[model samples]
Structures are given as structure tokens and as C-alpha cells.
Target chain A: MRIVLVPGVPALLPSYASIEDPVADLRAACHHAVAELGPRVRVLASSPLGERVARHLLGAAGAEESEADPTGALVVANGSAKRTVKAPGHLDERAEAFDDDLRRALVQPLPAGLAGIDVDLAAELWADVGAMPALAELLTPGTTAEVDYDDAPYGVQYWVIRWS
Target chain B: MLELGRHTFADDATLMMAIVNRTPDSFYDKGATWAEDAAFERVAAVVEQGAEIVDIGGIKAAPGEEIGPAEEKARVVDFVARVREAYPDLAISVDTWRAEVGDAVCAAGADLLNDAWGGADPDLVDVAAAHGAAIVCTHTGGVTPRTRPFRIEYDDVVAAAIADTVAYAERALAAGVARESIVIDPAHDFGKHTFHSLELTRRLGEMVDTGWPVLVSLSNKDFVGEALGLPVGERLTGTLATTAICAWAGARIYRVHEVVETRQVVDMVATIAGRRPPQRAIRGLQ
Candidate 1:
């Protein structure tokens, strides 16, 4: 039941506006979910910078540095979100370009055993709402483990990989 | 969608009919028996297990011991009335070839007339037509000898079975029975050997091709017993296997003993065939 939320490109603006610091918001969500759900909770943030920020937040939460290993990490990104905000006039071409960029981002090299990547902001937003843990379980080396998304109202596409 | 009594058969799924024999010498459950309470329990159990129809037979119809029309009608009428009273929504089918029994059962709330004699008795067809109830015409040809002597004579078994069943269908239709209300059964294990049953099942798709649903009753029959060398009690697995094969070959209705298990197997087969998988909810973030 551990959940990791990755902010969609569109929701990132509102998220940063509320928290003023995107990294701090991600870390607080993870720590809160873990404290609420007990020790089983492990929240992960997507992106190399996001991962570094998550580790720092864990230390600030009074969690031992040794207890917070690289194994619990997730990289979240939204491929479709880029297409949503692309130039409205040339929608099809811009959407295609956005998709290519998202695919490039997904296929890029990352730390070994990274947990699943979240492709949308809604999943990441769930962490702030105390719904899911910040860290996501890795289904495969580069795949996100299946999570209970029945409560998710609209379809949000996301991906995850194993935490190195 | 076609409606039989309160039950509906729209899409092609194996409609299960549990056998309920009131006679003392039924082929499968001869020694193990029922009267009033037992019959009621069996009816409830089968219906709970997803049986759309419960076929009750008064006469043994095993090999010998054929009762007169009056006796058969009396037994059928009384049994159908009791069952109908117990399960008002149940689709009760009286298994008899006597026209008198058909009439009595219809009047007593039976929804379908199951003629094992293949409508040989014109009066039976007339009764079914008069009541506007569905008819299950099974191929039970020739006289039932003392022990059912083996007979293997036919230019083409599949063609002959189809032609004979089609002829019966025509007769029932001509007798005023609606075409949709008629269901044809190849009558496995009734005056037919194992090979005959096998051939009938193999060509069962032809029955479906006739533009009507086919009901194949291979539940714990002699063929399955002989094939698996198991007793009647142990033939459920084999019967389920044959039911699966027949379903793949396009038999729409299955008369089975283990209704729930048979339903699962048929559902799995249907799933693999991509007809419809188990219901699942798709989830994602808004």
C-alpha cells in the first residue's frame, strides 16, 4: 500500500505556489505518510534533484541517515502533461514533440534499481493529501509496482522503477 | 434475447439444467433418491448453483419400465405442482414423452416440455404447442429394449442425427410451437453408443448452425465413465472436460450435475476465447 506521488507538469505550479518549495513539499508528504502508516511507509520522489532533496528531507525528519538508503527512490515525470500545455495552435505537432521529449526523459540513465516513475502530478499530489506513501515499490528494474488506484477519479498515467 | 419462463438466454453461454429424477430407477441416481423434502432440497440446491432450469422426470426411461400415459401424467402433474409451488420462479421441465403428462405439467406451472421420444408422440407436441411453453426435443429413437442392445447402422451418423432432429423441429413448428422455443438435444446415451455420442458432440456445431441453440447433456454419461474408467460419482471432472469441449464446439446449453463447477469451466473457456473476461474495474488518478 506504499504510494509515491509524482507531480504532473500542470499541477507543479499550484503545488509550488502552496508550499513555496517543491522539494520540501515532496519530503514532508513522504515523512507524513510514513509516520501515519507506521514504519512500513516509504515515500520516493522522482528526478535526480528530487531524489537528493528527498534524502535531505528524511534527515530533517529525524530519520537516521543509515535507515534512509538509496533503495527507496522513485523518479516521477508526466509525458502527457507536456503535450497538454504545448502551443494550442499547432496542437498535433507540439503534442508529438512533447511526447518525444517525455519518452527521452523516461529512457534516460538513472541510479541503479530506481523505483517506478510517476508520469502524472495527481499521483504525487496524493502524498500531500496523506493518501499514499511517498516511496513507490519498484515492479521491475524500471517498472512501477501496481498500486491501488481505485480511488483515483480521473485516469492519471505514471511509471516507476526500482530505487538504486 | 429469448425468454423461457422467467429466465433469459440472450448471449451464448452454457445455460445449466440440473437433473431431478423422481423415479426410483433413474440411470444416474437410481438408488440415491428423493420424495418431497429431498426433491425440494435438490431443487433449491440446483437453482442456487445457477441452474436456469430443473428437469424432473417421473418415468425411469432407463431401458424398460415404461408407465402408461395416465400414470405418467399423474406423477408429472403432482411433482410439477409441488415444485412450482415451492419455487414459483423456477422453470420446471417435465421429462416425459406422454402428451397427457405434458398437458398436466403445463397446467400445473411447468414452463417447458422435454420430450425424450423426439416428439414421436404427436399428442406431446400438441400439448407443448397449446401451452406455449418451450420444448426440448431429444433424439431417443427405436424401442428401449430390456438392456438397450447396441446398434451401429448409419450412412452418416452426424447427418442422420441432424436430419432427424431437424425433422422433429419442423414437426414441432408445424404443431404451433414457436421456432425460438424449441431446443434440440442429440440425446447422448439414449439408444446411442459411446462412438455415436462422440460423433454427435464432434458435429454439435452443425446443430448450432441450424440457427437454434443446442443443449448437450453429457453429464456423467456412460461414454465419460467408460473413457475415464471412473464410477458415476467420480465422473464430474471428466464431464466438466467434455462440457468445456462442447462449449468450444458451440453448444449453448449444458445439462449438468455439478452446475457451479461447470459454469466456472465454461466461463474460463469463454474468457480464453475472448468472448468476455471476468469483470474488472479500471483505476487511475483524476
Candidate 2:
């Protein structure tokens, strides 16, 4: 089984596209990460926007959603939106620490730590991690993870990670 | 594809035709670029401003000292060669109604003949065809070249413009000019009163509907000056307002003195009409 993580940015949608792409690097990262998910996949997204982005990407890559015993999974979630003063959440002192903790849990395949993430603190930091608990179910105690993308662009932390 | 000399543009692309006057008496600049070096500089500047074509004219549209073919060729031919040599990809257009001048400039590397006089010389289209050059066919209500309207009245000015310009386009087609190489202009204020010019600006979409790309030369013309009660120098605002309307109505080419301002207006209008996407739109889209 393969799993990839991506962010739900509205600019990735065709309806919101610009003549000159504002989020070109993010888009490329999303495309690369989504392409790793095989032909038949299941989507794990926290919000409707994330689901839409996942569906669009999957549709563009000629992949389809599978409910019964999928070959791969696409997880849509992102780090805190409050990493900087110009961040969407307008500067939270604890955002960097929160994202660092989440990054460690994913990179180390600490399934229990991911499952025990503080949902109340995530809300305060404007992090969209509701569907991350699903990753805990897919991951195991001793699995190797590859981090494909990690950045704080537009003051929002985004990561495209893969685990097998 | 819309072919302008060696350059070819897709059907939906909007173009800017910058005005580069070789005359010392043209209304707007009034001898500012009458010298050869100055005119060349103007060409370079407008190209930097994203102009797709340069309409170089020898004689001022308003009546001035007579400029026969010899003098007109002297004014534009070698200059066209210089510009073509420097900016090999830029489309060079000579604003001449005489076929002799057209042939000479085309031989000197001009890609278009901007017949602002509404095809006064019948053989101009033939010259354009022979050189594989594009032509701008304007409607002047049958008025003589360099002569303004004297009590010209039309039952419907827009109707007359469409009929005459479309007929002129057909004449070019019959003369073996490529179908994509011909464009039509209503020749605002050339042979019309203030009200007539205003009406043409309002109904420019009718001309666009003819399926031949429409070119509008409304840069600081008398129509805008008269309508706004402004002088020639201060009509940029009015000119841009009319340009926005025509752009919304699908005018494909703009002939203008101010290249940057006209390009901005056309782009903004195209975005509003849903024909163009924004350049880097991410205020709230991020």
C-alpha cells in the first residue's frame, strides 16, 4: 500500500487558475505526490475543499476512487496557517512547534503519537489535521517514510510525504 | 492564425499597433520624433512596451505640405529597414495609401500596410499580396485622403462603416491577399462628425461580428477631443475609455500613440469579458 500527503489549495483548481500561476511550485508538488498513488485509491480529506482538490488531481492523473480494498490512499491535510505574521491565521506563537511535532510523528511513523494529537490546540493554530488520525490507522510502528515536500509558503505549512 | 508578415498570432490574441510618426506635423507629437534617430527610438520604446506592430507614417493625416511617393518613401523605407534589422521579429507597418509607397516599404522589410486613408489607391492591396504582407482596410465614407469630413451625414454611420469596410475587405480578398492578413477599421473622425464617430465607437461590435479582425485607431483622435471638450494632449483618458469599450466588443488590434496605456485597457477589458485570465491572481485565491 502507498500513501501520499498534499495540501488543499484552491489555486490548484482549474476554476481558480491564473494566466501566470501564483502557486506553481505547490501545484507541481501536489501533482508529483498524487501521481504516486496508483490507479485505484481512497481519499482521506478533512474538509470538502480538500476532497475537491483530491478528486480533481486524481481525475487529472487518470486515477479513480476505490472504497473496497484500495491499492493506495491520498491524504489531504496541512500544517498550521499561523507560522508567520503574514500567515492566514495572523501569527500564532505555538504554530512552529506544533508543526514540528506533527512532522516528527509522520516522519518517524509514530502512529500512536499521531492518533493522540491535540485537536483543541490544532484549532487554535489554524491547522487542518482532522483527517490525520486516519494516517495513524494506515501507518505502523516501524515503517520508513519519505518526505517529498516541506515548506511554509504564503505563511501556510505544506508537506507532501509518502509512506509504504 | 492571423498572419502579420512573418509573425503569426492565434485567432483570439489581442494586438497593439503603436504609432511611429515620421512626419514633423502629425497632431500628437508635432515633430517630437520627426528625425530618423528619434523615430527609431520611439519604435524601440513601444516594442519594449509590448507593442506587436508599429504603424509608421510619412505624412500627417491632417493636411500639410504635399508628400509625393518619392518623399514618402524617403521618410519610411530605410527606417523600416533599420527597425526590421534591429528587431527582426517585430511587425513593421507603413501608414500609406499609395501603392508605390506600400511596395517600396514592403521591399524594405515592412510586414503591413496601414491604409489609414481607406484604400485610396486601388493597387495597394495588390502590393500587399505580392509581398505577402498584411493590410488594414479602413472605411472613410469615400472621402479623399488627408481630407476631413465636410457635412458628411449617414442614415446609420455604423451600418455604412460595416458595409464599406467589409466590402473593402472582400476587395482585398479578391485581389489575392490572404484571408487572415486583412483587417477592418471604421476610420473614426476621418470622414465623420463628432456624433458619427461616437456612434461608431458605441456599436463597434457590429464590425467585429463581420469575422474579419477589427482594428480601431482611436488614440487621441478628434472624436475623443471633441466629445470630452479636451485638447489633443489631454485626450488619453477619453481615448482609453473608448478603447475599453471596443476591447469589450472584441476589437483585435489597437493603433495608438500611448502603447502602455492602451495595452492595459485592452487587457483589463479582455479579463472582464472572460476572454483572458488574470496575470498572477492570488489575492484571495491562495
Candidate 3:
């Protein structure tokens, strides 16, 4: 089974679109990763907003939203949004280290660090990791991640990763 | 869709028709662009400022010296050809009330005939139809060309405007002009006093409801100046304020001297009216 991850960036939705896209590269990477997740994909997200974003990405990728014997899973989550003074949540000294740890957790074949993330620290750093624990059950031991996109363009850490 | 000769625009599209006066006695610019080179430069400036059309006029709307058809053609025909050749993609409009000058400009590659004199010339629509060009049919309470309103009174000004302009639009349609190529205007300050103009501005939606695209030439006219008690050069604020009101009322085209400011006002009003999306909204969504 294939599993893909995309950030729950509001700018990626049609309602928040601009004449010139602010997250062009990130959106393209999300579409690319989501398209690789076959027709029947189940969406997993922490909150309602995250689920909406995940579903929008799935629709944009021409994938069917199915929970009955799904072929793949789409996870919606992102790291710290407080990486700089210009960030949405403003500057937090712990944001860089927290995002670094999240980046490390995303690339590992097992992602043990993601499953064991401290919820309090993640909240303080303005990181969204509620959907990460589901990846631990979906990805098997030998499954490896192909990091398609990784950036902090808007002072928010977003990654587009595909696992199989 | 609005089929303006060589160009077609979506129904919801708002267009800016920048004024390019080729005469020496126009009210706003005076003689700023009277010379051919100066007029061409004006076209370039407005085009850079994102104007969709240029309304070139040979004679000032307010009466001064009597300009015959020969002089009017001399002023606008070659200039229209020059502009058409230079800006092949731009929608070229000639502001004239005479069918003779309209024919000459249309033959010179003008895309639209802006009859600001309220169709005093009966054959203007035929000229527009013959050239496959668009026409702006305006209401002037049946006033003669180059004349001002002294004591004109209408029982229902808005109703009169809607009826007259719609009838003119139907006349154009019956004269072989394409359905999408006809537009209506309630020629503000042409034959109406300040009170009449204000009433027209306040209830412009009735004209919009006629299912004809409405064009408003409200740039630094006497009505706005008289409303605010300001001079011609200081009427931008009042003009934009009135423009916002008209835009909210669904006016499609704006003929103006200040393109950039008017465009911004129209866009902002359209956005507020829910007809247009914000240009780049990331304030809280980021």
C-alpha cells in the first residue's frame, strides 16, 4: 500500500487562491505525491480543517475518497509555523529544533521519533503533529520515504513525502 | 460576453476605457495630448496602466469652436489608424457623434464608436454595424450635441434613462449590430443637471437590469465637481467615491482620465460586492 503526506496549508485550497500563487512549488509537490496514491485513498487528519485540506488535495489529484478497502492513505499534517519573526505564530526559539526533529522523523523508514513526539512541546512550538501517529501503523518496517518537497517558505515547515 | 470588434470579454469583466483627447479644448486634460505624438504617448501610458480601451475624442464635449465633420475626421481618423497599427491588441474606441466621422474612424480600424452625444446622429448605429464594431448608446434627454442642461426636468430621471438607453440599445440591435456588441450609458452631465446626475448614479442598477452592459463616463465631470463644490483638478476623490457606488451597482465600463485610481476603486468595490475575489488575501489565512 502507498502512503503520501501533505501539509494542511490553507493557501493550497481553492478558496484561498491568489492571482499569483503564493505556494506554487508546495502545491505542485502535494499534487504529485497525492496522484501517486492510486484511485481509492483514505484520508487521515487530526482536525476537520486538516481533513478538508486532505480531501481537496485528493480531489485535485483525481483520486477517489474511499474508506472501504482503500489502496492508499493520505495524511495531512505539518511542522512548526513559528520558525521566524514573520511567521503566523511569531518567533519561537524552540521551533527550529522541533522542526529539525520532525524532518528527521519524516525521512526514517520506521519514523519512531514521530510516534513518540511530545504533544506539549509540539503545541508550544506551534507544530501540527496530530496526524503523525497514524503513519506509524500504516507504514511497515521496510517502507522508505521519498521526500518530494521540504521547505519553510512562509516561515512554516511543510513537507511532501511519499512512502511505500 | 462583450464582443467589442476584435476582442471578447466575459460578462463579469470590468473594463477601463481611458480618455485620450485629440482636441485642444477638452475639459480635463485641456491640450495635454492634442499633438499626435503626445496622444500616442498617452495611449502607451494608459496601456501600461492596464487600460482595456482608449476612447479617443476629436472634439470637446462642451461647446467651443464649431468642429465640422471634415475637421473631426482629420483629428481622429489618422490618429486612430496610428493607434490601431501601434497597439494591435488594444481595443480602440473613437468618441464621436457624427456618422461621417464614425465611418472614417471605423474604416481606420477603430473597434468601438462611443457616441457620447446620445445618438443625435441617426446613422451612427449603421456605421458601427457596418464595421462590425461595438457602440455605446447613451441617454441625453434628447438634447442636441455640444449643448448643456439649463433647466431640464424629468418626472422620473432614472426611469427616463433606463427607457431611453434601452430603446437606443434595441435600435442598435435592430440596425444589424450584434447583440453582444451594444452597450448603454446614462450620459452623466450631458443634458442633466447635478441633481439628475446624482439620481442616475444612485439608481444605476435599474439600467444594469436591462441586460445591457452599462458604461459610465463620470471622470471629472461638472456633476461630481458641483456635488463636492470642488474644481476640475480636485475631483478625483469625488469621482472615485461615485465610481465605487456605480461599481457596486454593476456598471461594467468606466471612461476616465485617471485609469489607475479608478481601476483600483472599481476592483475594490467589485470585491466588496462579491463579484470579484481579493487579489492576494493571506492576512489571516497564512
Candidate 4:
């Protein structure tokens, strides 16, 4: 099954659109990765807002929500939002190490590492990872990961990754 | 879409019509650009400042020396040709009330005829149509050209303005001007007192509701100056405040001296009114 992961950056939502997009590169990567997740896909998101973002991206890619005999799964998750002082959650001394570990696990397709993420630390760092544990059950031994986007723009670590 | 001769703009687009006076005693600039080169420099500067149209005028609105048709043509015709040769895409509007000068400037590649005196010349619309140029139909309450308001009174200024300008627009349409090419203006302080101008500004939406694009010439005019009791040079703040109100009310064209400042105020107000998107908003969304 095809699987793609996109960031739950609020700027990606249409409600927050600007004339000159602030997250243009990130949005392009998200759209590119999401488009590969064929029609009639299920979305896994940590929060309602994350689900909304996933649906918006899916709708934009001409994909619809489905569960029966689904083509692929779209996961809305992101890294620490407190990587800098100007971040939404402000600077956290432990954020960089946390996002670094998350990045390594995502790019390496390490299901065990993703399953071992400390929920307490994730919450404290304002990271959305509640739905990520399901990724452990989906990633097989032969699965490969490709990072489409990786950045800490606006002090928020965002990644667009595809695993097949 | 607004078809201004060689250029076309979106219906929702807000335009800045920069005032470029060829006269020696225009009120705002005080003869600063009376010379041809100086006026041309003004055109280049306003264009760089992002003005979409330039309203070129040979005679000041206030009463002055009797500038006959020949003198008016001499002041604006060659200058219009010069600007037309330079900025091929710029919308050049000749601010004249004489049909003869309108013909001359339109022949010289002028795009719009800004009839600031409220259609004083009966044949001006014909000239605009013959040249395939747009026309700005202003409401002056029947006052003659070059005369200031002395004791003019209107029972309902906004209603009067809507009636006059819309009728003039229809007249232009009858005279073969395109429906999209005709624009209406509430000539502030043209034939009305300070109170009349203020009421027009406050209720400009009535004119906008006429289904015609509204052009407001409130840039440092006597009405704005009198509203804040400030002089011409100090009325930018008052003018911007009025401009914001008008923009919120959906006025399409702003005729002004300070193009940059007026454009900023209009854009900011349009954004606030949900007519335009924020240029690059990421503050809390990020």
C-alpha cells in the first residue's frame, strides 16, 4: 500500500492563505506527496485540525475519503513546534534533539523508533504524533522511506515523507 | 473589466489615478510641474510609485486666466503624445471639459477623458467614443467649468450626485461610449460646499450601487482640508482617513496627488474589508 506523511502546518490550510504563500515550498512538497496516495484514501491525524488539513490536501489532490479497500493512508503529523524563540510554542531546549530523533526515525523507516516516542515529551514540545504509533503496524520490513520535504521554517519542524 | 483604451483591468481592481497638472497654478503642486520636463518627470515618478493612470490637466479647477481651447490644447496635447510614446501601457486621462481639446488629446493617444467639470462640453462624450477612449462622468451640480462653489446647495447631496453622474454615464453610453468604459465621479468641492462633499464621502456607496465604477477625487481637496481644519499640505491624514472609508464602501478609483500613500491606505482598507487577501500573512498561522 502507498503511504504518505505530511505536516499539520496551519499555514497549509486555505483559511490561512496569503497572497504570497509563506509555506510555498512546504505546500508544494505536501501536494506532491499527497497526490501519490491514490484516490479513496483514509486519513490518520492526531487532532481535528490535523484531520481538516489532511482532508483539504486530499480534496485539492482530487482524492476522496474512503476506508473499504483503500488505496493508501495519509498521515498528518509533524515535529516539535518549539524549536526557536519565535516558534508558536516558544523555544524548548529539548526540541532540537527531539525533532532530530523524529527525523532519523521517519527517514530510516524505523517503526520501532516511532513506536518508542515518549508521549509526554511530544506533548511538552507541542509535537503532533498521536496517530504516528499506527505507522508501526503499517511499515513492513521491505518498506522504503523517501523524504520529500524537511525544514524548520517558521521555527516549526515540518516534513513531507512518502513510504512504499 | 474596465476598458481604459489600451489597457484593461479587473472589475474588482482598485486603481490610482495620479494628478499631473500642466497648469502653472494647480492648488496642490503650486506650479511644481508646470514645465513640460517637470511634468514628464512627475509622470515617471508616479508610474514608478505604481500609479495605474495619470490624469493630465491643463487648467486648474479654480477660476484663473482664461485659457482658451488653443492654449489648453497646447498645454496638454504634445505632453500627452510624449507620455504616450514613453509609457505604452499607461492609461493617460486628459482632464478637460472642452470637446476640442478632448479630440486633440484623444488623437494624441490619450486613453480616458476625465470630464472634471461634470460634462460642461456637450460633445465631450462623442470625442471619447470616436477615439475609443473611456470617459469619467463627474457630477458638478450644473456649475460651469473653472468656477468654485460660492453658495451652492443640494437638498440631498449624495442623491443629487448619484442622479447627475448616472445620467451623465447613460448619456455617454448613448453617445457610443462602451458600457464598461463609462465611470462616474462625485466631484467633491466642485459645485458643492464642504458639507455636501462630506456627505458624499460618507454615503459614497449609493453611487457605487449605481452599478458604475466610482472615481473619488478627494486627495487634499478643500473638503478634506476643511473637515480637519488643516491646510492643503497637512491634509494627507484626513484624506487617507476618507480614502479608507471610501475603499471600505467599494470606491474603485482614487484620484490623488500622493500615489504611494493613497495606494497603501486603499489596499489596507480593502484587505480589512475582505475584498483583498493579505500580502503575505504568516504571523500566527505559522
How close is every model to the real structure, measured as TM-score? 0.64, 0.97, 0.98, 0.99
Tens-digit lDDT track of model 1 for B65-146: 7678776765567878888888877778878777877888898988888777676677877888888888887775554422
Highest-scoring model, TM-score: 4
Tens digit per residue, CA lDDT, model 2, B182-216 = 99999999899999999999999999999999999
Model 4 ranges off by over 4 Å: none
Cα lDDT tens digits for candidate 3, A1-164:
99999888888889888777888899899998899889899988888888889889888888888999998999998999899999999999999988888888788855677788988998887788898888877878888899999998888889999998
Cα error of candidate 1 at position A121, Å: 14
Q: Which stretches in model 2 have alpha-carbon errors above 4 Å?
A: none
Judged by lDDT against the true structure, how good is candidate 3? 0.91
Residue-pair clashes per candidate, as listed? Answer: 31, 0, 0, 0
lDDT of 4 at B58: 97
Tell me how far the alpha carbon of residue A150 in candidate 2 is from the true structure, in angstroms, after superposition: 0.6
Model 3 CA RMSD to the hidden true structure, in angstroms: 1.1
- The per-residue C-alpha lDDT of model 3 at residue B226 equals 97
Best by DockQ: 4
Report how far off residue B243 is in candidate 2 (Å).
1.2
**Chain A TM-score, prediction 3:** 0.96
Q: Per DockQ, what order, best first?
A: 4, 2, 3, 1
lDDT of each: 0.61, 0.91, 0.91, 0.93
Predicted chain B of candidate 2, TM-score versus the true chain B: 0.99
